[model samples]
Target: MVSPDVFYGALTRASGRWPLSAAARELVRSGVPVFPCVPGGKRPLTEHGFHDAATDPDQVEAWWGQHPGANIGVPTGAPSGFVAVDVDVHGPVDGFRGFSRASRAGLAEGWQFLVTTPSGGMHAYYPATPGQEQRSWQAARAGIDFRGDGGYILVPPSEVSTTGAVAGYRLQRFNAGASSVLDSDRLRDFLDPRPAPRPPENPGLQRQADMSRLAVWVAARGEGERNRGLFWAACRLAENGVPASDALDGLSAAASDAGLGEREITATVHSAYRAAHPTREDSASPTVRDSSPAAPDDWFARDPVSRPSSVRGLG
Candidate 1:
C-alpha cells in the first residue's frame, strides 16, 4: 500500500544533506523501516542487525542520535515490500552485462526502481507480491544476487568507505510520481532460470556415481582449499566426458556445502573447465596426469634409498 509520493517527497527534502542523519530520518518518515549502519560500512549498529530496523520516530531519533553519521539500511522482501536484484560489478563475471543479457532474453522488462552502488554495481528494486516468500540467492554462474526476505540493502545517500572496494549508494532511476510495481514473477524467472533438461541417462557413463563422488570431494574442501579442490574436480569430470554444464551444477552444490561463497565457486569451476578445455586450439591444455605419491615411477621411485623416508610421503 506504500506510495511513491512518500518516497519522492522524502528524496526531495533530503536532497542537499545526503549521507546525513536527517536524510535517514526522512526515509523513515516515508514508512520505510530503516536501521543505522556503521559509517562507511554495511555493518549494522544494532546487535541483531536488520531485525532492529524501525519506523518509530522516537527509536529512529535515538539511533541517529547515538551515531550521528550512521549509514542507512533498508530490509528487503516482506519487511519493506520489495525485492532487490543486486548486480555485482566487482565479481569475476560482468554483472551489468549479464543483466543486459537477461533483459535481451525478455526476462527483465518490468518497471522498477534502480539504485547504483558505490562499487559501480546496481540494485533493481521490485515490489513484492503479498504472501510471496522469496529468499536471497545468487544466480548460478553469474555476478547477480537477490536481497529478498531475511536480507537488507543500503539505501541511496548511504556512504561506504571510499578507501575500500565499495564507494557508496546513489539513486539512479526514480519515477517520482508513479507507483509502478515491478513484475515479481518475471524477476524471479530471470534470477533463478531453470537449467535445460539433459539427455536420457547413459548407463555406460556411470555419470551419476562419478558426479556423487565429485560432490562429496568438493564438499570436503576447507576455506583456503575450496578453489583448488573445485577446479581439480571439475577438470577430472571434464576428462571423464561429463558436460561442463552438468559438472558445474554438481560442483555448485558441493561448493555451497563447503561454505564457499557463490562468486568464488562459480569463478573457480568455470576457470577449471576453461583450463581443461582450451578455448583456442593452440592453447595449452591442463595436465591431468596422475601424480599421486602412490603412482609408480614417481619421485619416490627415482631414489627410494637416497631420499629420506619422510620425504617419500610428498605427493
Candidate 2:
C-alpha cells in the first residue's frame, strides 16, 4: 500500500484546469474507487468493504501499479446519474484561483461545477446518484465534490448540506485502493483508535457516529427519546455557563451512566466538539451504526466510560 503521505502528494499534483473532480470523473470513467485514508467509517470509502461489492483494493493497486492500500473514496455516483450545476468560490487567492481555473475549464467541458475541492483545500461536492456510499465520501473530502465518486481529485469533506438525492462527495490523491480487499472486522480494529495526522475530513465524522452512540446511549430509550437526548446534550453544551468541553463531558458522563462508556464518550465528545467548531475540512463518518459489525468493539466495550453505571448520568 502507498503511504498516506505519498497519496497526499498525488492530490497536490492536481493543478490548473484539471480540477480534482475532473480527475475523479476520469478515474471513474476508467473504473476505480477512490479511498480516502481515515480511521473508522468517518467516510464511506474508508469504511466500505470491497469484496462484498465485487471489487478489490489489491486489484485496483495492481491495475494502477500503485500501492495496495491508500485512503480515498470510491465513485458512489450511479454511472448514469449526473446533473449539471454551477459553482462559486468563497475567499482568498489560493482557493479562488484554483476554483476559477477549474470553473473556466469546467465551462469549457460543458460542466457547470467541476473544480471545487482545492478551492477550499478541504470539502467539495458534486451532484450524482445518492447513496450511503456517496455520503461518506463527501464527508471525507471535507471540501471536495463528486457525488460519491471520482475519488480525491475532486471530493473533500464538508458538513455543508447538499440538496438533492445525491449523498455527499469525497476526494482522492491518486488511487485509494479497492474497498473489497479489506477484512471488515480488521478494518474496524484499525479504526478503533485511528491514527492521527488525520485529514480535516476525519474527526468531524466521528461525531456522526456519536449519533449512533447517542442511540446506543439511550438504549433504554426509544429512537425519538435518544434524539431528544442528543438535542438536549447539544443545548447544554451550548449554554452560556458551560464550556463546550464541560458540556460534552457532562453529557458523555450521562451516556456512560446509561451504560455507554469512555470510548463512546471519547468518540462522541470529539464529534460534539467538531460539531460546535467545525473546520471547513471535517466531514465524513463511518457508515456503520454503533452496534453494527462494521464498528469495532474496542472502544465502546473496553472503554472505561462505556460502562453506564460507572459513568455520570445526564439530565
Candidate 3:
C-alpha cells in the first residue's frame, strides 16, 4: 500500500533539497508520519512536488471531491480551544517523558483528551468554551490547530507561531478523522482543579537556563538576561542540525535578551550540554505498526480520528 520507501518518500516530499533538522531526520528514519509545513501561506517548491498541501481546505476539497478515492480524513468540529503550558521544570530530566506524562494527567483532570507526539511531547484538547481561543501563547504550553469542529489535532509546521512547531517532532495529520472524547463533566468531576503531580528535581535547569541566556546573547544581539533561557533552548535545538559556535563568551548580546550577563550563561550552557545530549535516535517513539498504507476512508462516517479522553499512544 506504500511506496518502496514510505518515510523517505514522505521526507523527500517535505524537505526537498535542503538539509533537514535532526528532529526531521529522526522522523524520516523512524517511519513516523510527517507533514511538511509550508511556511504560513507559502506553498511547496521542490520536495514540495511530492505532496499537495492536503491541509489547504480548497485543495483538500477539490482533491477529495474529484478523486473520491483519497483517504484524507478531515477532523470533525466539536469543542474548540487551545491549551498551552509554559512548563517550568526548573531543570532537566532523564528526558521530558515524566513532564509529558504529568501534563496529560493534569489535562485529563481538566477534562481534556490528550495526544502525544513523537518528540516525547503531548497536546491536551480541552472543551472549547467561550474563552478558549483568547488565551495567550507566551511560553505557550500548547498551540493552534483550530479548524473549529473536532478542530485540528496535529501540529502544522509554523514559524510565525511558536506553538507546537518544535524542531524534533513530526506532526501527523491523521486524515483518518477523530474519535470524540467523553463528557467534560465526568472528566472535570474526576479532576476538579486539575491537580498535577510535581515534576522531579531537574538540577540542570538553572544551568540550562543560563546556557539559554548565553545563546540568546549570541544570536539576538540583545542583553542576555531577558532572553537567556530562550537562546539556550534554541541553540540546543540547533545542535541537531549543524555544529554550534563555542565562543559564546566573546559574543555581545546575540541570542539572549537585554540585561543578562554572559559568563554565567556561558558556563551553564557548557555544563548542561555535557549532561543532556539527546541523540537523533533518542527522540523516537515506539514504532508505528502496520507500515502498510492506511485503509481507504470511503466509509467516512464509520470512524473518526481523535484522542479519546482516556487513551494515549505509547511514546
* RMSD list, candidates in order: 15.7, 19.1, 22.0
lDDT ranking, best first: 1, 2, 3
lDDT of each: 0.66, 0.34, 0.32
Better of 1 and 3 by TM-score: 1
- Local accuracy of candidate 3 as per-residue lDDT tens digits, 100-206: 45436653334233334434444443334443222111121222122233223333222222345533223332212332222333332232221122332452353
Best by lDDT: 1
For model 3 the local lDDT of residue 92 reads: 40
Residue 127 deviation, candidate 3, in Å? 1.9
Q: Clashing residue pairs in candidate 1, if any?
A: 118-168
List runs of model 1 lying over 4 Å from the truth. 163-166, 175-253, 256-315
Which lDDT value does model 2 have at 219?
42
TM-score, per-candidate, Cα-based: 0.62, 0.22, 0.25
